[model samples]
Every structure is written in structure tokens, then in C-alpha cells.
Target: MFSDRFDQLVQALRILPSVGPKSAQRMALHMIMKNREGAIGLAQALTEATDHIHECTICHSLTEDDVCHICSSHERDDELLCVVESPADVMAIEQSGSFRGKYHVLGGHLSPLDGIGPEEIGIPYLIQRLSQGKVKEVILATNATVEGQATAHYLVEASKHLPLHITRIAQGVPQGGELEYVDSHTLSQAVHNRMRMK
Candidate 1:
């Protein structure tokens, strides 16, 4: 319903997560009308960031440097590892300021139907990290969704024999809510009130 250029913009916008055709059109028009320069800057930033960013070798979080800030920081506890589904979760935890441990980004949760299994999401890497005998505790900070729960259970079962204490981040994170969307206060409380899984 738009010109070729406008349609191209809409198509590009639709590739983003949670953006539908209507939203893509609305955003495209909004950018075109409100501030074209700002829109161009946004596009440039996206391009530059995506091109420059690479996964942190130690944690798998997006970073321009070889190691992420958390992995390199002396302030973070090396003996505690927080296992999260994505980098966004790391940011949320960091923002809450409740955890001072390093993180291991799983890349994503296990979804057999989607062909995302243990190997695909770096579960083996996690086991290897545990085998090194540095980390003492692993906080299963995956989301509360079915896939997240399944991933957490799998990790717990797999690492049962290892010399590490496994704990899951508390629930009560509003049903269908994500870590990135939860407020800092609620996230802090959840981290503080985390319970050991039986």
C-alpha cells in the first residue's frame, strides 16, 4: 500500500522482533514525518552496532571487545555463575545491581520443536565451564516459560554430580513477563528471594 521505498522500509522494520506490518508502517511514517535525521541516525547506529558487536568468548554476551565487562571486572565474583537465556537477561540483572557474579549466556532456551537442543545452545560449554572447578554456584536465571523451565531442569539434572550448588531465580515474575521488561526493584527482590530447586 506504499511506494517501493516505503515498502522497503516497512519490510526492514518487520524483521525486528514483535513488530507487525501495521507497526512497521506506523514507525516508518513516524520517522519520515517527525525527524528524518533522527531516523537516519537510528539506522546508522543499528548498522554500526550490529557490525561491530561480537559474542563474548567467556559469556556469549554481545560485545565489541573479546571479553564482556562482567567477565573482565574484578568486582564480579568469579566463583558464582549466573546462567541466563540471553544477553538481555544479563543487562536486566546488572541493572538490578543485586548480583555481582559473572554470567553465561545460553544463547536461547531449549526448544526441541525448533531444533534448539543442548548442543545448539552451548550446554556443553556450560558443563565444560563447570568442570574447570572455578565456579561454585550457578543461578538458573532463565525465564519462567515452559522452555525456560525445561532448560533449567535439564541443567540441574545434568550438573547434579558436579561440585556446584544449582539454584533457580524466583518466579512471581508476572506470568508471561520477560526479565528485560520487569522493573529493577522486582528483579532485585526476585534475586534476593531466590529459592533452591528440589
Candidate 2:
């Protein structure tokens, strides 16, 4: 239905999450017709970000440096840790400006069907961090998805021996909500209304 280059562009766009073939085609054609400059800028930005971003050594959040700004900031509370499923979750929390603690990015959630396990997403590292003695509380900020809940439970079990308070963000978030998609006010409210796991 389109030229080889256009078809290739659509296929590439389709690789993005939730972007079906129709949407991808629409985007490709839009780029070709309406917003060529913006499209070029977007492509360049994507390439640059992909090339420069590296995982933070301490928290696994994306950063250009070895450590992310949040990890390096002395203003944040080192005794509080927010465990999230990805860097995007960290960003969502940051946008809310409600949390002034450190973060630990899990990289991904626990999904048995997808074969992602504790070892696959650096849960061991988080346990090790908790063992270091300064952390007082851990906020489970993973998404409200099933896999996210499973990951949170795994973390709770793993940190059982540690002298730390573990809590999960509240559920003002709609079902099937991703942290990245949640608005700042809702995310902030969730953090403020966090509850301890029974």
C-alpha cells in the first residue's frame, strides 16, 4: 500500500509499544506530509538519547553519567528508597515533586509468563542496598499491574530480614494504570497515601 521506504518507516515505528501497523502508517505519513522538520528533530533526538543514555550505577535509572542526578543529590533523603519498575516511573515521581528520597529502578517487573524473574531485573542489588544499614523505609512504586504487584511482593519477601519499613503506593490509580501514564497529582496522592503491606 506504500513505497518500500514508507513501509520500512511504518514497520520501524510499529516497534514502539501499543503502536499497531495502522497507527505506525499514520505516523509515517504524517511525518512525510505535515511535520517533516519536527519529524527529523524527533529522529535526531531519539538517536542521541539512545546513544548517550546509560543506566545509573546506583539505581539503574537512565542517565548520561555513571550516576543519575537523583542519586547524586545531597538534598534527597538517603534513608528513604523508592523502588520503581523503570526510569519512567522515577520521572513520574519527580514530576510530582512529592518525593525527596532516593530511587532504585528494577529495570522490569516480575512476569513468569515472560520468564522475567528476580535475578533478571536486579532485585538482588536492591536487597543488597537495603542491607547497607542507612535505609529506613522502602516505597514500592512499581506500576499497579499484576507483574508489578508480583515484583513488589518479591521485594517484600526479600527484605524480610532487613530492619526497614516497606510500604506500597495507594490505589487512586485506575486499574491497569502505568506509572508513566499517571498524572502528577494522582501520583503524588498515591505516594502520600501509601500503606504498609499486611
Best by TM-score: 1
Clash-forming residue pairs, model 1: none
The whole-model C-alpha lDDT of candidate 1 against the native structure comes to 0.92
- Expressed as tens digits, the lDDT of each residue in 1-198 for candidate 1 is 668998999999998999999999999999998989999899899999989999999999989999988899998899999999999998999899899889999999999999999999999999999999999999999997889999999999989889899998866567787999998877887888777899
Which lDDT values do the candidates have, in the order given? Answer: 0.92, 0.91
Off by over 4 Å in 1: 172-198
Runs of candidate 2 exceeding 4 Å displacement: 172-198
**C-alpha lDDT (0 to 100) for residue 72 of candidate 1:** 97
Give the TM-score (vs. native) of candidate 2: 0.79
lDDT per residue as tens, model 2, 43-158: 99999999999999999999999999989999999999999998889999999999999999999998878888889998888898899998999999999877888888889999
Error of 1 at 163 (Å): 1.2
